[model samples]
Target: MAAFDALPGAVRDGAVIVHFGSPLIEQRRLAAGEAVVPLTDRTLIEVAGEDRLTWLDSITSQSVARLRAGDSTELLVLDPQGRVEHAAAVFEDGASVWLIADEADAEKLAVWLQRMVFRSRVTVTVRSDAALAGFFAGGAAEARLTPSAPNGTPLIWRDPWHEVQPGGHQYAAVEGHPASDYAWSVAVVDDPAALTAPFAGALAAEALRIAAWRPRWSNEVDERTIPHESDWIRSAVHLSKGCYRGQETVAKVHNLGHPPRRLAALLLDGSDVVMPAQGDIVLAGDAEVGHVTSIAMHYEDGPIALAMLSRRAPVTELIVRTHEGVDIAAAQQVIVPADAGATAGVPRLTRLSRRPVAEDPRNAR
Candidate 1:
């Protein structure tokens, strides 16, 4: 981060590079696969030993036990109530399984993983020495550039949001989602200075992610967020997988009912020149329905954001009230459709059936 931050025209937010003073240009370069962004806000964890993949499979939501080397996927750790706890990109390199998670979640997740390893032949360690560089390589030649492998395989985790995996489900009702073609991946390196590609900042990278309707851990998840609400089940969850901590709730909510809330993308009104901040109140007329989660300025899409709206929130325009008292008119787009879940074709009984039917002696005659 220090080396990348020292680059010319680099403007930073904390340890992260926001942009090289020309976000629009940097966004263009990044979208075209001509630039790589240093991911200072991400951290790596290595789970090594013979039981690594099987242990991970037994705990997480993804079907990872049989993952072949060089395979990439994502998984979510859920609380007992099916709320999201931790999310990460998973890659198998034969020697170990690398989990690239957000900086805010890495430490806690690693600690939890350690505690869960009572007799399992696995060692979970934080790879604090490794740094990540993100690139948008959609099967391009630029994607071939990779760092040296530490365990007989390149440490690159390609994102799996382009399409739903086996045993996964999508909630977005559209025929084609913008993220269906999104190609983003991260390369692990020991030093940030080792990358020679043109640099984009975290801001540019975030804008592209938001534009693709991607749900990230730090931005989209909250204490009560379930995978179904953000449509995370599309990639991070295996619907047909064996039992795990939150499997009951995951199965129930997806097959029997809808999530209490759904994720929505918004196109904000740029007339105010002030963007709504995270946690800002979103409204349907006078009723508060949701709060803004992630906001960004896209090169082509203008101002955009993602929010968690209540199931009661109608499918119409919404109002985003900023801290400065500016009411930004936002047009809402559905990421998770209203009819997302209850997919299982089971014969559901109604409450009326639970009531005792009246009996008459004359009926017996």
Candidate 2:
């Protein structure tokens, strides 16, 4: 921890780094694999026991019953209504399952895991001793990094957002996904001080993520958020996975219905310098269509943000209503298309047309 704080021009909020010096410079270096960011906002949990894999598979939104050691995947915990509640990166080490989630969700997810261990052999424990460091683990940088092998299996939860996993399906069908080239990953480390590379911060990490159209839980989720809305099914939710808490809604929405909302990216007009913030309203003319979930200033893309929009929202240019009651022009980039669902193509029974009878003279009198 002291090693990061001791770096030149380091700025921090509590234990997390805001930026080392320049967020843009750090972003460039981080993207090129010259830097790593200490992920203090992320926490870890260990689920130990012989029944861990099957137990997790029965409850979460991923197919993890046969998860092999050293392999990486993510899962989502959903409410009965199928709204996203918790999400985690999963890694098994033969002896136990390791879960990495945001600090905001770790404690609750740990407790829920423990409570769900009725007859199962699983025992859940939050690993206060572990932490994360994120970087683009591509090329030589992946080789130089040494991930923790505490149980004789290195724990590196690689990001699978670049492509759809085996049991997963993608609702996002862009011509060229920005995330296709994103090789972002996080390594479970014994200590943040062990790293020797130049460090970036959360700001830089987030900018690159927003530019890539990545839907991170902390920013993208609300009480009403479903896996389909933010296109989270691309990585987190398994379409054909066996029964889980919210599997019914998951199957229903995918096969017969369209997701009520979709995720979109807004490239705000940088001319006015009014940076719209999270929770600001997105307006299609005068009606509100969506609200911003995350925002960032990319090195090459200028100002950008991710928003959860109504499925019927305008596909054209919109206006961002800032917190100060100012409106700024924004160009929309669709992440999840409006027609993103009903993959089953089930035929709908058409309604019969009703004949309009002539108005009664008695009603007019």
Candidate 3:
């Protein structure tokens, strides 16, 4: 077994791994014929009933009506006003459907769903204890990527790099299937201690994820944010789907107007010091441009951060203003903006950008 000795203890406990390299490796080997990794900081919500898919599709931003027993979709729950309430990986089996969401908000989402079950035949429950894991590295590894819990189940994951790059890599949750849409086979290990025991000298995967510009649910989303503001519609929002709670706002802002805020990746120069704390103000000149969502010290790229800022802020270069009012030099990489219009055939204008944007962490290209 190829133990992940380079992984950190926190990650081994229940976190994802983000391995950086000078050049992306095409192949990696794993022990037990399964490359197991912990899906940390996430929770799973179970919805069981005959109308599980119907109930979800009516409330979320995706077309769950089309999802079969062995399929999954990236789903986003919106506030009545169209702001992001929560995001999840919605998967279905013959018997039930599972929603994988942020650990911090899984219970909240589950409760909300239960409240909405006024007359539906659906039942909602929190299954965060049900572990989620995956693995993939080289080509044609999809067949080997399977969830350990159930055999022959369909897996669904947000295609981390859908807009910036297509088919670069595939992410999905598996239940019963022998394999998934990844380069390596993966499984959910009940033994967190044993599973993470072999990894050595690795930092928290959250740091790598922050550097990658991947927007996690808890770290990146909140009530103040809309799906478009977070660039979530790219992977989570199914624009063409039928009416959901926040569909009107999503459609209007996306098609005829623009979102108030945009998500950016900041390049911080920390050669002189450590990175600033989260919620620090970012400035352009004297203008309060935005606030940092996540920050990290990259192994190769130095200091970097993800932020949601006003649309008028500098798209090329910006500055991070510390609480003490000291300004640090930084460059902005606009990953997901409200202005990017919808894409064709994919069912939404979430990807309608005026020009090519920078590389997003989810899809490093």
lDDT for each residue of candidate 3 in 1-365, tens digit (9 for 90 to 100):
12333344322333444432211121122212223335555677778888888888898877777667756557778888998887777667767887877677888888989999989999998865665554433423233344444535544343332232221111211233112232222234444444432221123344445554557677677667877675666557776767889888888777667678887888887765646778898888878888988876655577788888987776667889877776788887766653554432344465656535554565556
Number of clashing residue pairs in every model?
A: 0, 0, 30
> Which stretches in model 3 have alpha-carbon errors above 4 Å?
1-37, 134-146, 150-187, 190-204, 324-326, 341-365
Q: Which scores higher on lDDT, 2 or 3?
A: 2
TM-score to true structure, per model: 0.94, 0.92, 0.72
Over 4 Å off, model 1: 3-6, 138-144, 348-365
Evaluated against the true structure, the overall lDDT of model 2 is 0.87
Query: By the lDDT metric, which is better: model 1 or model 2?
Result: 1
Cα lDDT tens digits, model 1, 36-94, are: 88888898999999999889999999999998789999999999998899999999998
Q: Write the per-residue lDDT of candidate 2 for residues 52-73, one digit (tens) a residue.
A: 9999999999989998888888
For candidate 1, the TM-score is: 0.94
Which residue pairs in candidate 1 collide? none
The CA lDDT of each predicted structure is 0.88, 0.87, 0.61
Give the C-alpha lDDT of model 3: 0.61
